[model samples]
Target: MIRRKVVLHFPREKVDKPIVSKLVRDYNLDFNILKASITPKEEGLLVMEITGEDEDYRRGVDYLEACGVEVQPLSQDVARNDERCTHCGACLAVCPTRALYLDGESMEVVFDREECVACELCVKVCPPRAMEIKY
Candidate 1:
C-alpha cells in the first residue's frame, strides 16, 4: 500500500459533492482527514492522508482531477528551529500526535518528524516562534 498526505481544493460548485467518499467506494482507498474547511456552495479545502494500492491511488487522483478538484501535496509542513526554541513546553500541550516531547534528563524539547502530521497546532502555540510552517 502507498500512503500520501495531500490537500484538495474544491471549487465552489463542487463543494457539496461527495467527492472524497467516492474515492473510498470506487477506488478502494482509505483516508484520514486531518483538517477540513468545507462550506456548502463555497470553496473548500481538505487536508488528509490517503492509503491504497499504488495504482488505485493514481487512478483516484486522476478521478479527482477529472471532477475539477485541485490536488497538491500537503503544504503546511512544520519545522522547528533549535536555536530559536526556548524549551518552554508550549508545543507539547498542543501536539495531538506527541511528536513534540521533553527529554526527561536534558529538559529540552525534542521533535519527532515521522510522528508529525503537520497539523499546525505547534506553530500557533510556540511563543518564541520557533515552530514554522513551510508552504
Candidate 2:
C-alpha cells in the first residue's frame, strides 16, 4: 500500500482543531505535531501521513485546504554539496529530520534524503552554505 504524506505550516491561531479532529475521526489518518524551534511558543506544524487509495489522499488534501491549512509536499534536500563539505558536521547538528550524519571513522557527512523533511535547518545552520534546498 502506498502511503501519502503532507506537511502543513499554519499559524497557531488558525489551526482548526475541530476540523483536524473531525478528519481523524472520519478517516484513519496519522497526525504528528512538529515543534518549531524558531517558533517555539506556537503550534509549529502538522505532518499528516495517510495510507489508502489515491482518491483518499486527494480528498484529505482537499479537505485540509478547505480548512485553510497551507499544505506542501515534503522534499529531501538536506546536504547538497557533500563533496565540497569540510566534514564540519555543523549541518548535522541542526538537521530537523536527522538526515545529516557524520561518519565516526572518516568524519564525512552522510545524507539520508529519505529522512529529510527539507526544513532547511541544515542549510541555515551550515556556515559554508553547503546545504542548498531547491524547494
Enumerate clash totals for all models, in the order shown. 0, 0
**Which residue pairs in candidate 2 have backbone atoms (N, alpha carbon, C) closer than 3 angstroms, thus clashing?**
none
Cα deviation at 70, candidate 1, in Å, is 1.0
Top-lDDT structure, candidate number: 1
Point out the worst 10-residue segment of candidate 1 by lDDT. Answer: 73-82
Which lDDT tens digits does candidate 1 get at residues 31-128? 99988997776789998899999999999999999999999997677888889999989998899989999999999999998667898888879999
Candidate 2: count the clashes.
0
Model 2, runs deviating above 4 Å: 3-17, 35-59, 65-70, 75-79, 104-106
lDDT of each: 0.91, 0.66
RMSD for each of the candidates: 2.1, 4.6
Give per-residue lDDT, candidate 2, residue 5: 53
Winner by TM-score: 1
